[model samples]
Target chain A: MSPDRPTLTATPHNVGVDAAVAAARRVVTALLHAGDGSAAAMAEVASRLTAVAEHLEEHAPTRDERLVDMWAGEGVTRHDPVTGPENAVAPPLPLSGLPDGSIQGTVTLGLPYQGPPGCVHGGVSALLLDHTLGVANHWAGDSGMTGTLTLRYHRPTPLFEELTVRARQVSVEGRKIRTTGEILAGDAVCVSAEGLFVNKHLPRPR
Target chain B: MSPDRPTLTATPHNVGVDAAVAAARRVVTALLHAGDGSAAAMAEVASRLTAVAEHLEEHAPTRDERLVDMWAGEGVTRHDPVTGPENAVAPPLPLSGLPDGSIQGTVTLGLPYQGPPGCVHGGVSALLLDHTLGVANHWAGDSGMTGTLTLRYHRPTPLFEELTVRARQVSVEGRKIRTTGEILAGDAVCVSAEGLFVNKHLPRPR
Candidate 1:
């Protein structure tokens, strides 16, 4: 249970340009984990990066593009961060639907996804489970936006080890869809998530 | 309510190298969001970045340096991706403990933190709340790793907007500590999280 309160701040200040930018972002993420500790060398690299940033800011779009705004980045089409086939950010889950309507996928997180020493970052586990639950909703024919996500870490999800994920639609009531999923490293279950998604009839950007 | 399944995974893979690498990651995250779609120009930048990565991997640390594994790298000392003063991965919550043993902080997430089109990533919200709840436990003299985190999203936490967060220790049940917190965008409550932390007596790397 949570406190019923109001805490409205402000709307988004800037909108992202297009989906292509996220692709570039995935690349940047790969490079960041791969840097040396030379101050002079890094300074030189920073200057170049700054120049690129300034140019984009100068010419960046003012209006938001309705392109997919997901970690998977127009998933199943081009490269993406979460589920892309060629990108380093992906756990690269190749999913197949079971006969029971539940979805199952396999992935292996590497050093790039670490947060707690050798274990996978807790958020990364949430991210993967969220996406998996969303996929469950999509299979249910109610592809909707995530209204809420709840997660419990039974144990640390490991990296560099092949893991299996399974998600199923628990229920679909009106616009609200509920789904549950669990992550497993072999037979051992590590993380579980429950997500609520709302399918909007009104026009909303993807 | 969860399966009392006894399926635990293997231990973590490895600890991160050093604090300096996180600083460099912050740079990479920024540069990725800044690219303006010049493939030729980015390719050139990529080449230089590749060289830097190769050099660092060759000279990376072989032993633990006791550096913080958090975005607060070398914490309160150097810049990092999650809790740094000048990093995009951080919400930069400036927190203080209240009279009743609660902690409060204010944060405004800009670009590089978006999950949905205009809303803050649910995982990001969880990340901020998880850290805040842990900070509250620290104030109460019982800091521990997250065992379970349950969150409910009442409304979308917007990006690029100022939000207020508060956390308080609720109860201590043996080794388990339960805490609750909420995030508000002004007055509208966007997200709420309940965390369970258990301070282990065994030696664990930072």
Candidate 2:
């Protein structure tokens, strides 16, 4: 007889994954409807995609009951709902699929993340850069917490648009990883960032 | 013979030495009033200080304009205001005299910096760490833009109370500064931070 199995907790305890997916779908759809397809619009889209990713992280399974492994084993690759854009900005592929030294992702933004009247919050922009640069460090095989991130906002990132972010490892010395990236609305870069991420020397899971 | 006097432009430009001084005064005053001399209070105070700093940066001067030699010769330190609690926290300094390489400040909280009803925003806590660490870095003579700030929030930093942030420089490299700091409510450390700040290699003034 099998030993008493630990009860499994269902995901989506917060607003329910379906609700989050629906909200994200609504935002993406609105962006598609606007159809400006400008670089600014793309950056906005990237922001929205980040929110969806955040929601998924909030609802996903936890590892070890203490920390949620944000970059661990992935379950969903992409979710294309009916309300999503016809050519909806595809969800970012998992880091697991990427080559050992590269990181890339796309996202969309909407109203909920707005800080200024119609622009993304500066803090939110910093968050995006931190996560993206962190991923770059991880891809370069140097996993660490963010030590510092410097953002230069060349232009105000507009809301409700699709954006692309690409992070590339610059160099690594001991426990510190240096990387740089930019958030592109389309071809226009709205925000650029460079960072130093320091590996904390935590034990890797077996 | 009289020396030819340069006529001053009177078009109400935003970037000027007087404007910077005014902005600094406003920021310093807001920071002083915002703190209630407690760790939790410092969280809220840091948020208000960030808003004030951002406003000052936005209106008072551009980074390039700030780099002008005339201003540099004036013996003014164009310190960037604390942006947020994640990477920096500047608590209100009560006493005029403190030893070099020390972090000293107090603050109070209000509804304006609230994240969830009565609690201070998590990001606000991070902002506090950033500012406090930056100050520590400044004291250590390794002043630079925050390259990375890491914050571990052990508990919810509360809202509306006197709080203190004590920080000190740990070590320094050629261009990298290392510092450790904590936000305390009486005896308990609410949040702790370790930061790496890269020195700004400004060109020598002509």
Candidate 3:
């Protein structure tokens, strides 16, 4: 069985579609930190979430086969969840094009992404870097799968604060694309990464 | 305000409590890849999930504020969406003590944790490493927050497969614990990581 359970493999949509996904993400975020003060509250919360799950199960595609890897084409971690629009979790990093062949993005992670008390989760830092580096490779005309990613977390990345990330392709060798980038809060560089992405050999369709 | 959303401080629970959290995580894993085949299905799923959200919101404790890092003491990341049980995302990697004072864990990533087609998200791999390294540091009696986590994705870490992770503290400075670990599928070393965990200087109780 494909690791990717069957998803509604829909193409990313317009603003209207994105907004709805964003709203769902907001709720998910809220739940991420919704602390329990009472047992009754916890049970009620679980039941409700479960009902939602049940409902999804009911309406879900009753399929014998599943669609595989539809990595959100516009996936920008801290912005979208894989479960959000086009199977992307909402609030996607709305990265924009840069004339200089690099990509820039901004996002504010919340409770859901926390690792330390007030810092964004370390793996999350790398997620942003990996995605950005992949995009960087794409812009450089070398889109591929990540063969290796190396990261350095210099300082704690704070949550609920806007962070800036920039990436550019450094060099290319055969099927490998080397790229580097950094995450910043105002002037502090919190995390930096270099990734080696390899272009997948596509099966030529007859 | 501290970026870590204010949470209700609570201690970890016992096996029974952990079992319940584990159950919740299972449901979440189902939802993560719950494919919506129709708009009506999506709405129904939304409504059910919303009921769950509403129950939590209404019964949730409205209080002054508190910050805590549960770290899956009761965390079930895949199910609880990172908030339900002790501040964790469900389908969490539950690591625990061994007689030898080392820590070991196992987990399976589904659709939501995918990156690069059939593989686990790179950042997720790093997250597991960071957590395991911290656990190892704790076992070595040198527990601390992460100072720097460096990871090398030797190859694509597969999903929905049981992956074993092991960590150990290699050395320690006055306030730093240097650790290393790997995620494996049987015999293949998919990812390797080393981290520097730093002891946080806690504020002296007045």
- Candidates in order have lDDT scores of 0.57, 0.44, 0.58
TM-score of chain B of each: 0.69, 0.55, 0.74
> Model 3 Cα displacement at B152 (Å)?
2.2
Q: What DockQ does candidate 2 score?
A: 0.03
Give per-residue CA lDDT, model 2, range B1-206, as digits (tens).
Answer: 11232111111123332232223233222222222221223333233333333333333333233224222443212222232111111122221114453755666643323332244444445555655665566555677655555655455566667767667878787887877777777677776777766776334323
lDDT of 1 by residue, B49-114 (tens): 455445444443432322222232323312222443322234346666776788777777654455
Rank candidates by lDDT, best first.
Answer: 3, 1, 2
Q: State fnat for each of the candidate structures.
A: 0.14, 0.01, 0.26
Error of 2 at B32 (Å): 38
Which 10 successive residues of model 3 chain A have the least lDDT summed? A1-10
Q: Name the runs in model 3 displaced over 4 angstroms.
A: A1-24, A38-40, A62-64, A68-91, A201-206, B1-32, B58-64, B68-84, B201-206
User: In model 2, which regions exceed 4 Å deviation?
Assistant: A1-100, A201-206, B1-206
The digit string of per-residue lDDT tens for model 2 on A1-206 reads: 11232111112222222233333333322232222211223343333333333333343333232112311243321111101111011122122214445555566665323333345544455555655665566556676655555666566676667777777889989887788888788899887877776766333223
DockQ for all candidate structures vs. native = 0.18, 0.03, 0.28
> Least accurate stretch of 10 residues (summed lDDT) in model 1 chain B?
B5-14
Which candidate comes out best when scored by DockQ?
3
Score chain B of candidate 1 by TM-score. 0.69
